[model samples]
Target: MPLILFNKPFQVLCQFTPQEGRESLADYLSIPGIYPAGRLDADSEGLMLLTDDGKLQHKIAHPDHKEAKTYLVQVDGAIDAAALARLQAPLDLGDFVTKPSKAVRIAEPDWLWPRNPPIRERADKPTSWVAITLEEGKNRQVRRMTAAVGFPTLRLVRSSIGPFSLATHPLMPGDFIEVPANAIHK
Candidate 1:
């Protein structure tokens, strides 16, 4: 089965399921016989994996596989080293304790396109960028985690997944690329 890497744009659904007046994978991907390995929320943007092979899907998306996912996040407030350290440490998220993750401050990218609806900008309020990596996928994990650390996310983008990096592929919004099976693990 062929593996596909998609750079899902903001407000685009990750699955083929039709949403009420919202964009979905059906609008962007035309490849037949392949389905998402995992998902990115409609409000989020970045890397997503798709495959026709159930086993490969399981290997990539299943929690047991512990594949690390990296994200570049813009938060609503200035981020400090202490807050970053808290993210790296386990958190008690009520239902379960999150796994160890990595967080570090980064400079905002100059090439990011303006968000469609636009993120609210406050001249008096400050924002910061951070790159975070997690081995576990959870519902809005990045958003929730950053919020828990007192820096609510303003924008989020997945920069890498396991062995694949968006840096090399360089997908603009709504673009996708096919990866041969042999290229996936290398």
Candidate 2:
């Protein structure tokens, strides 16, 4: 079976199992047996890969693979050079220390679609975007990392995972397409 690349929207849960008052993968996907290779929190948006193959799913999700996942993070404040440097280096998040990552300030992506419920904006505050790529994704790591650096994440979007990317395969929210399962290995 091929892999399914989906553009997950904000506030959609990352499971097939139904939950009260929350939309799950089942809502957008009726493809039987397919499971998400990795999870994006309900509050997060963008690229997700689903596969029916158990081994492939595990290979992408497991920390051992150190599959690179990149996020476009919209955060509070100007997101100066100091914060960018701090993000690139590992900062103890209390529960666990993170590995060094690639973090750089970027202009808001031209291709980005707005969130259904747009992020909060304060009259005196300006938000900045940062492209952060990490090999190991711990739970809510990007959100936690930004908050630790004094610029809390207002919007979190996964732009790519491993060799697959929204840039290479652009899809609007709730849209999906099947690609060769071996695409990621190339």
Candidate 3:
């Protein structure tokens, strides 16, 4: 089975499972047999891989594969180089330390679509943006990392995973495109 790259929209559930009043992938995707290789929280949005192939699913989701996932994070506080450096360093998250990851400050793009139920803004406080990449898919890792550095994440978006990128795809919120099975291996 081939793989599909989906730009998951905010508030949309990552799976076909019914969420009572909440929206799900079944609302946007009609392709049969394909299941999400991994999940993105409904509060976050961006690139997600789906496929009918079990091996490919394991390859993408299994920690042993070490596939890189990158994210663009909007944080509550102004991020500095020192803060970014701490994000890059292994974070002692109590249970276990996070793996080393890349983090950098970046300017916000005007092209970004307005998120539904827009993030809260404070007159006295400002926010900044950063890009971070990790090979491990720990639950809420990016959010945890940012908070650990004293900048809580306000908005988060997965920008890329392995060879697939949201930048190259014409996906708007809730849109998806299928790629050849071979593309998954590349």
Worst 10 residues of 3 by lDDT: 108-117
Q: RMSD for each model, in Å, please?
A: 1.2, 0.8, 1.1
Clashing residue pairs in candidate 2 (N, C-alpha, C atoms within 3 angstroms):
none
State residue 112's C-alpha deviation in candidate 1, in Å. 3.5
Question: Which whole-number lDDT from 0 to 100 does residue 26 have in model 1?
Answer: 94
Q: What is the lDDT of residue 29 in candidate 3?
A: 92
lDDT for position 181 in model 3: 76
Misplaced by over 4 Å in model 2 are none
lDDT of 2: 0.93
Residue 74 CA displacement from its true place in model 2, Å: 0.3
Model 3 over residues 103-127: C-alpha lDDT tens digits?
9998985556778889999989989
- What total of clashing residue pairs does each candidate reach? 0, 0, 0
> Candidate 1 — what's its lDDT?
0.88
Please, what are the lDDT tens digits per residue for candidate 1 over residues 63-168? Answer: 8885789999999999998999999999877787899999999998665656778889999999999999999989999999999989999999998898887887
The number of the candidate with the highest TM-score is 2
- Please give the TM-score that candidate 3 achieves against the real structure: 0.96
